[model samples]
Target: MPLSDKHPTVKRRRSQLLNHFLAFFVFAVIVVPVNFFTTPDHVWFFWPLVGWMGPLALHTAYAMGLFDRRD
Candidate 1:
């Protein structure tokens, strides 16, 4: 069965999914290593914390309109 456009949540979820994928790809391949190397060794916990939280945090903000663009 095909998804109907009548459900607003479906559209929101679809948008969220696209944002999540884009966020994951950008952070995983580009941002992770840069932070891993440049960060100080004393803050070892920061790396994993940032690595996991960054994408979720950013995406959540975007979806919530906190980090949205006007253009």
Candidate 2:
């Protein structure tokens, strides 16, 4: 049997993925360059990158059901 596309979980996952993509795109396009010129001496981009990556990683794990409590 084919899976139902209208399922709530499926819809939530789709929206979450789209949001993640948009956030990453905005950070790459705008934040990176701005940080590059604002402080030419040090590469401060890593600060934001490291900050965002932590949460992003957790979000990925949760979305993949890795953190689901299996009883």
Candidate 3:
């Protein structure tokens, strides 16, 4: 369905998903290359990926209504 025709909650979830995806993309693009060239020996990209993934997972759950209290 088109975004304009979806319910408000659906629209909000879509927006959140898009925002999280873009943020992850930008972060990986910048951080991975910098960590690769600047510290080729250590290769610490996993640290950032771990940190970001935790919150991203939580965000996905919340956006999917895992935490919603529908009574």
Candidate 4:
């Protein structure tokens, strides 16, 4: 076996990570403009984007093997 992971679940996590990134990109694209035009002062769009980023970051770390340990 290789030093890296070779599990089906890891593969799924990587795929999900990509999909999540794409979805978040689309969400930001849509919300930013709407928020800007409707209420430019508050910039409420920033909150949701930041909130969504936390999960994405954790997902990315897992896919990158940041939490993996071999014994």
Best-matching candidate per lDDT:
4
How would you encode candidate 3's per-residue C-alpha lDDT over 1-71 as one tens digit per residue? 22243679867886988899899989999999999899999989989888999899998887777877756
Clashes of 4: 0
Candidate 3 local accuracy as lDDT?
0.84
The C-alpha TM-scores of every prediction are 0.38, 0.72, 0.84, 0.73
Off by over 4 Å in 3: 1-5
1-71 in candidate 2: lDDT tens per residue?
A: 32257878757866896798689778878877887779777778877877888888888776666766676
Best by TM-score: 3
Compared with the true structure, what per-residue lDDT tens digits does model 4 show for residues 1-71?
Answer: 22335677777877888998999999999999999999988879989999999999998988877787766
Give the TM-score (vs. native) of candidate 1.
0.38
Q: Give the TM-score of candidate 3.
A: 0.84
Would you list the clashing residue pairs of candidate 3? Answer: none
List pairs with backbone clashes in candidate 4.
none
Q: Tell me the lDDT of model 1 at 17.
A: 62
Q: Which stretches of candidate 2 lie over 4 Å from their true place?
A: 1-6
lDDT (CA) for every model shown? 0.64, 0.75, 0.84, 0.86
Candidate 2 residue pairs that clash: none
